[model samples]
Target: MRRVPRWALLSSGCAPVVLTGGWVVAGRLEGGSYDPATQTISVLAADGAAGAWVMTAALVALGLCHLVTAWALRPAALPGRVALGCGGVAALVVALFPAPSSGGSLQHGSVAAVGFALLAVWPVLAFDPDGRAPWGLRRVPCFAATAVMGAGAVWFLIEIQGHGAIGAAERFVTFVQSVWPFMVVASCVRHKRPAESRL
Candidate 1:
């Protein structure tokens, strides 16, 4: 089996950090009225908001990290890698099309939905059924992970329809999506063959 590279691990690990840090910093800079429970992260990057660049830069970095992780995950199936990379590109597109402060933009919502769906489904698509794959890439775990992400996405959509904590639901789904690559990379690194130690 091909081993995961150190750079992939680094990039994947940085994704959640960059996202959380960006939100915290943006929230701090914006001050007082920003409620994480009800508001979306994109609000931080909306037009005319203070510290918008912080969130924008974070989104760009997060997308690039996803692309890098996809490239580094050579052991996974090709279609899965393509889906992951395309998801990353969708994230970058989301950054490009920020929503307005008061309401959502159709383009931004479309790209964000695409990104969420791709990220949620990639794991299941990446799963190896041969039973020789790393722990994170195994069929059962991948299916479970995808199911959980799908549930979170449903909750987020319901929240968008004015049912519950929209910010919390979004954060839960996005944080999982951001962290999953790192888990997969770690599993690959842990199961590395003796001959592939250099990776």
Candidate 2:
């Protein structure tokens, strides 16, 4: 039972909302083209420089989101904390990289890409009614979470081709890193029964 700071938890979830939201808004601004028709913002891409800053902000936002979501939901969560911690470390490693010496920069950008997968795995395995999950199911997500984070580590050490340890990804990697936050929100909703069960 780790004691989590309230600010840390709030910041974690809120950061992603702000960063990702900001990026989307920025896109809409440039094109004046938030398409209600397609329900997408920034139907067209922005400048490369703008895109880079948006992705960087997003990476930080998602990382903090994982930590915060965990804290907020820790009471009902299983052993998935290991996943959260390892995934966070993995994100730090990848994000810290000028990223990977050898391959395309995408391979080296671990923070958002790998981090998103790891965070998603947490809910897949550990979430349950009122945070009371079957022991086996709990283990499954934990392992998945660890594996996801570990994969990022591997990317850092081997795949990056031995360059500097920190870097950001191209857009694809950023998307990979960020997609899970939405899923996390969904999983929280899945706990609705549990929330009511307590009542």
Candidate 3:
């Protein structure tokens, strides 16, 4: 019922924020392992398999969100939209790709990275806040710190709720990438709305 600006941004204006959130959460949902027994389809621990499903669903939703946002906008806004949407799609692709044995080599290729990229890009692309960049050393670093703290809070909330599926680092990433930005964007929408991206 609420015609929130957040909806406007996602459904029309800068859409990367929403897409990235979905993708990041999706990555967190993925569960995988190296199943040497089958010698096929890679393998991971039980939790990995479960996480994969969650991540997959989230990514699929994110992909759909990107598609909707991509087509909804005018041609004038295509470039930024493309960047944002591509980031989400790429995150999904990265997420679906098999992990290395050590799970170290391509960690940067994770969905969170794509989400982070989108968050970092949206303000500049949209210039949401009187057509100027929202992030400076101060605003961005403060927000980043807030995001880190928020993620820790989520980690604690998960423990309180007994929904412990993700590792601490993974939980932190989830909080920072998905929940934190989601909240920040909402705050921006409520008070600042979106601004034109600066040149």
lDDT of 2 by residue, 1-199 (tens): 2223445435445644754575565454545433322321122222243343454455455556666555554533555655665565554454444332223355444444565566546545454443354332344544554465445545544423643332222222334334443434444444334456788
**What CA RMSD would you report for each candidate?**
2.4, 9.3, 10.2
Tell me which of candidates 1 and 3 scores higher on lDDT.
1
lDDT of 3 by residue, 1-199 (tens): 1123345356433333443454344434442432222211122312256444544455455555554544433221334456556755754665466455444435534544555456345423432233322332124543455456556555544653563533443434433433333343344444431333332
lDDT of candidates 1 onward, in order: 0.89, 0.45, 0.42
The residue pairs that clash in candidate 1, if any, are none
After superposition on all CA atoms, how large is the RMSD of candidate 3? 10.2
Candidate 1 stretches greater than 4 Å from native: 193-199
Best by lDDT: 1
Give the candidate number with the greatest TM-score. Answer: 1
Quote the positional error of residue 118 for candidate 1 in Å: 0.3
Model 1 has an lDDT value of: 0.89
